[model samples]
Each structure stands twice: as C-alpha cells, then as structure tokens.
Target: MIDTERQDWARGWSKLKGFVEREGHARVPYEHKEGAFPLGQWVAEQRRAYGAGQMNGRRAARLEKLGMAWSAADARFQENLAAARVYYQEHWTLCAPRSAGALDKPVGQWLSNLRRPGALDGHPEWEAALEAIDEDWNPSWPAEWQRHYAVVREILAEESILAYVEPGVTVHGMDIGKWLARQRQSEVWAALADGQRERLEAVGVVPHVQALEEPAGAEEPAEPSTAPVSAFDRGVAAPGAVQGPARAL
Candidate 1:
C-alpha cells in the first residue's frame, strides 16, 4: 500500500513539474538573448520598459508603492555582500570547494583574487562586462555559454549542482545575475508588510540572512518633528497663540 502511495505521489510530482514547466516556459519572454542571465534579462526588460516609456502610469505607481519595501531588501543585500567580503577576507582558504583538486588555477582562487581591492577594476573581463552595459544598465553576456568566473566560480565549487559551467569554466552567468538580483530584491522585501511578504514568498523569493551584524553607531535618532512645535507652544506660543504663519497670512 505504501509503495502504491509513493508511486502515486511520484506521478503527481511529475505531472506538477510538467505543468509548471509548460506554463513558466510559455510566459518566458521570447526576446531572451542567447547569453543572458535570468535576472539580468528581467532587469534589462524592466529598464527597457522604463526607458521606452512602456512602463506607463500603472507600473510607475506600483513600483513607487513597492519602492520602500524594495529599498529595505536592497539594504539587506548590501549588508550580505559586505558580510561575504568579510568572510572571504578572513577565510579565503575555504573559498574553493573540495572537488577542485589538482587544478592550481581554480575559479575560487580567481574569484577571491578579484575580491581584493582593484583586482577586477582593470581586468579585461570586467571592462568587457561594463562595456556591454546598455542604457538600461543591462550587460550583454554570451547567452549560450556559462562563465565560471570569480564569485560565481566559488559558488559553483560549493555547490556543483547549483551551477553550470561552459567553455571557459564560467559559472552560469545567469546564476550570478540572479544572485545579484535576489540581493536587490531582498532590499524591497524587507520594507514590505505581511501581505507583500506572502506575495513574495508565493513566488519563491528567499533572502539571504545576514550571518553577522555591523557595529551599532553611538548616534541617536533625531527628535520627532512635532517636538519643536510642542516646546515652542509651551515656552512662547501660548501667550501669542496666533503667531508666525497665522500672523503672516
């Protein structure tokens, strides 16, 4: 009976997978370039739509409403990226996965090196990547081939199944773009309310939890805006309640 149930479950999963793939693939934009990361592609489309005036009032309104949530998510990503840099700086040794044996020129090493100050700033690859940036801030990468470059290379080393490599040992560039996008998306998600959280989660959005916190500043938050008004009323305004703006107009 258990075997039968298991088989049925398997069949159901297969059917579900088929349905999702069909629907998802169909919705995919045909304009997808040969070598574009998924997030990069999405970002490009967003930029194009925004630039070409295709986003329209409705889209702008929605984005503005969502902007605060998005900003929070962005802050989180910045924090994560900062944490990752700290981790790499302290534990550069574990940057490469165990599978990368005998290859003295592993991708992890290259990526770690790139993390060093100014290492990638002048690199030909970096320059090429930057040059391909469209007015919408989309960079053109080879669509068919995956890159196992730098940080992506490290991710590949850590999880082979999580990444794909191509001719130049490039980790799937799409994954890299997606990683960056998630970091950005987290910024949006952080400021959202419960309903927004549910919506994002329904779409499989997951943010990277910050493993550490930065030191807190000694400065306190500014006093509330109404403070001065209240103080002035008590100290001087009560005697001449009708003053300033009231007297002016």
Candidate 2:
C-alpha cells in the first residue's frame, strides 16, 4: 500500500513538473485534469496538506521549488497589473475602450470589468495601483467621455482653443467639432457634473453653438484627410468666431 502511494505521488509530481516547464507556473485550475488523473484536485490536496502541516517536508519543499502560486487570484492580478502599467505609460490614462488592450493582456476589458460595482471590493491594492496610475482612471462620468476629453485636451496643448470647431475638423479620427457642439448645447451643458464642467473649463472649453447657417456632420470619427485641419484651425479660420484660450493644452 505504501509503495502504491509513493508511485502515485511520483506520477503527480512528474505531471506537475511537465506543466511548470511548459506553462511557467503551477496554477492549474481546480477543475483541470489529465486523462483519468485529477491533477488539479491533487494539486489542491497538496496545498491543503501543506497548510495544515500534514504534507511531508520533502514534498512541500519540491512544490515550493516549483514556484507554486498559493493564491491564484493574486498571481493573476499581478500579471494583469504589469500590463496595465505599460498601457498607462503609453496612453497616460486607463480609461481605455472595452476593446483596447496592452502587453498582450486585455487590460482595457479588465479595467472595464473592475469598474463594475463590487468588482474590486476586497482588492484595495488593485484599486490603489489604478488610482496611482491615473487618479481619475474611473470617473463618475462615462469613460468614453473622459477619453474624448483627453483627446481634446491634447489638441488644446498644441494651439489655442477654438470658438467654433466646425463639423469637418477631426483629431485622431474623433469628431471633435460634433462632440463639442453637443456639449455646448443648453441641456447638455447643464447636465454635466460640476467637476466635469470645471475640468472642461480648465482646458478652455466653454458653452458654445455652431451658427445655424453652417451644415455639419454627426457624432462620428472625423473623415480622413491629408494636411487635415484641426479643431483650433477650423474655429480660428471661421469668420468672426472668437472663443477659447490663446494658450495650448
């Protein structure tokens, strides 16, 4: 009976060794198995034994040498976090669209998932890391709004804010003029949170409306163009239009 147990242990160890060599981590899911062998169940049993001080010293040492991840959630979160830091470094914000990703990780979708209420309830460290990366990573407003705001702010840095950004103007493919027009409308401006309005104002945005005489496009990406004009250029070039700051973002 004892010899049979030894053979069983050896078989499980061999499988785990192969798994670690291939996957680089001993994080097999609980429901995972190999043919008839309950490898994941065996791994969990080993962990439980170690925690309860019932595992043999040699066996525990071997598992430790394999770099077993005691807390799968922590290990996974850390990996995703590394990707997120890289993303933030490049984009300067974590308000990524649902489809956005970085470092081969679906960090944008990951962040969006966390934005759901109670997603990070017990993970204060994750929350803190996100906040450190971008204090407003998760704002009260729609993340899409925050993303567009970021684009407009970037444009403002290059030139003065325009009084009337026309429909044709585009920046990074975003219809800056159309978005601004909606923001400038009476009802829309009033609906904005005070903090949101303050941030927009800081970037030189003010309540605005396109003149009735001009035709425009809808809320969509600015059409592609060579030597494309900017929101600043469009509004500045428009006849007698005067608003926005002289300083750039």
What overall lDDT goes with each candidate model?
A: 0.35, 0.74
Against the true structure, whose lDDT is highest? 2
Tell me, by TM-score, which candidate is best.
Answer: 2
Off by over 4 Å in 2: 1-70, 160-166, 209-249
Q: Per-residue lDDT tens digits of candidate 1, residues 103-197?
A: 22343344344345675454453433322321111112221111212343344346432212212232222344443234335575576555435
Report how far off residue 73 is in candidate 1 (Å): 15
Model 2 per-residue lDDT tens digits across residues 1-249: 479988998998888888889878786644457777878777877776666788788887888899775564655665677678787776667898888887688998999999999999988867986797788889999997887777767667765665545454565466776777677677899999997899888877767544443336656655555876556446655776644432222
Compared with the true structure, the alpha-carbon lDDT of candidate 2 equals 0.74
TM-score of each: 0.17, 0.55
For model 2, which pairs clash? 156-248, 156-249, 157-248, 157-249
Model 1 TM-score, 2 decimals: 0.17
Model 1 Cα RMSD, 1 decimal = 26.2
Q: Model 1, stretches more than 4 Å misplaced?
A: 1-44, 68-114, 118-249
